[model samples]
Target: MIETIVFDVGETITRDDRYWASWADWLDIPRHTLSALVGAVVAQGRDNADALRLARPGIDVAAEYHAREAAGRGEHLDESDLYDDVRPALSSLRDLGTRVIIAGNQTSRAGELLRGLDLPADLVVTSGEWGVAKPQPEFFQRVLEVAQAAPRRTLYVGDHPVNDTFPAKAAGLRTAHIRRGPWGHLWADDPKVMEASDWRIDSLTQLTTLIEG
Candidate 1:
């Protein structure tokens, strides 16, 4: 039985529309252009941040992030940013006695904002806080530590194949490839993703059913 359900923030529990849109605004580029570039990079298996680099070649994204913060336009998250199914799904899982956790490749600020939302999760953490990102053995090690459960009893859910399905599977966690965002849709049916994911879900709501089953 799966005792814990760990989620990826971007494109999993949260929609990234505002995130990319804010970047577009900051970079002074058309939102569509940046969105398209993001899709392109995902298609090529490149880092999502490459979209920003593509928009402004040789741009220092880290520096620009600080610049945006200095100008009072840093990361922002709110209830509206969450997928409609997030609360209901998480609440349902918790109701089933499943330990729900939200851990993703997000910034420390994103972690704080997510915690501020007071979702039904037992824990909400990010790569920035852990000092390790996904697809890294150390990151999954931290997840295992926090879960306090055997790897097989933990289920990791996310949209990205490279960052989510593959490594999580390698860490011995049952993986669910959630089909929601760009990477989700693009790689949902790919052979490797299908192979890596123990389950493929179209919505977070399916997780409750998964746990019950």
Candidate 2:
């Protein structure tokens, strides 16, 4: 029986479009510059790791982000709210005897957003705190350890195949592919990859039934 769940935050529980849309505006950098930098790092082309390895780095983006959350910022930048089904679905799962945990690369900025909202997270593991990012296999392992769950009995759900599905699949955890727009093309229609997921849902509302099954 499924007993635990390790969820990703950004696109999973929390709606992230608002914060991202305003990140460049607050940084005083052109959106294009920020986009290029993030794109380089995300695409693994510019070598952010190399840059950090060269220097211990005085600034931590995650830390600054946490501080921002503590300061009660991001409200002005944010407009849209979290998904309506997220909390009720999670609550239903918890009521069904599932212990839901969080595993993501986000800073504790998640706490800031979530503290005000009525959400439930049994335990949380983050890349900022774990020193490792998703799809690394170890990320899910840590979550399993923290949640006292065996991979065979737990499910890891997230919006990305490479970041969420690949690692959880390798770690022996069941997987749920949350298909969203934006990155849908690279993965959405690929039958081979889609076949790998235990379940695929385009909306969080579908989770209630998927998990119930």
Candidate 3:
């Protein structure tokens, strides 16, 4: 039985359309162009941040990130920024005695952002704090350590096939492919990717039924 549930932050729990759109605007590039850049990186099996740096050579990423945060100061996510199904599903799982965690390959502000939302997770960890990112086995190992979880008894939920599903499955955690966001929907039609997931859902609300079953 799955006793632990771990989630991806961006687009998995928190909707990222506004965030990515803001980044595009800041870069003075079309949103689709930005999306394409990310897609290109994924296609080439490269890390997302590395691709962005390669795209804009000599870009002062730290400065750019701080600038973005500064420009959006005192701004935090509201309910509208989360998917309709997130809160209730997480609450339901926790109510059932399942340990819940948010472990994502995310920016430094991820923990702060989730804290501001008062999420129901028992623990929240980010790549910035872990010093490792997903698709890498060590990241999942750290997740298991921090979660105090057994890989075989844990379910890793996310939209990314490569970073979340594949790696988690490899690490012995069952995987849920939630096809609701850009990365999720982007690979939704890919049979190979979809087949790799242990469970697949169109919406997070379905998780209640799955877990209850």
Best by TM-score: 1
| Residue-level lDDT for 123 in candidate 3 | 90
Tens-place lDDT per residue, model 1, 15-127, is: 99999999999999999999999999999999999999999999999999999989999999999999999999999999999999999999999999999999999999999
lDDT against the true structure, per candidate, is 0.95, 0.66, 0.81
Give lDDT: candidate 1, residue 122. 97
Candidates arranged by lDDT, highest first: 1, 3, 2
* lDDT at residue 120 of model 3 (Cα atoms): 85
| Candidate 1 global TM-score | 0.99
Candidate that beats the other on lDDT, 1 or 3, i.e. the better one: 1
Q: What TM-score would you give candidate 2 relative to the actual structure?
A: 0.73
Kindly give the stretch of ten consecutive residues in candidate 1 with the minimal lDDT sum. 140-149
Q: What is the C-alpha lDDT profile of model 3 across 1-213, one tens digit per residue?
A: 778889998879988777767666877878887777877876666666654576577888778888877887423567789888888888988999989999898766777777778888899888988899888999999988876767877889998888898899889888899887667887877887777787898877777777778
Candidate 2 residue-wise lDDT, 55-130, digit = tens: 3346565565656657765443122456666777778888888898877866454454454464666865568678
Cα lDDT for residue 213, model 2? Answer: 77
Of 2 and 3, the candidate ahead on TM-score is 3
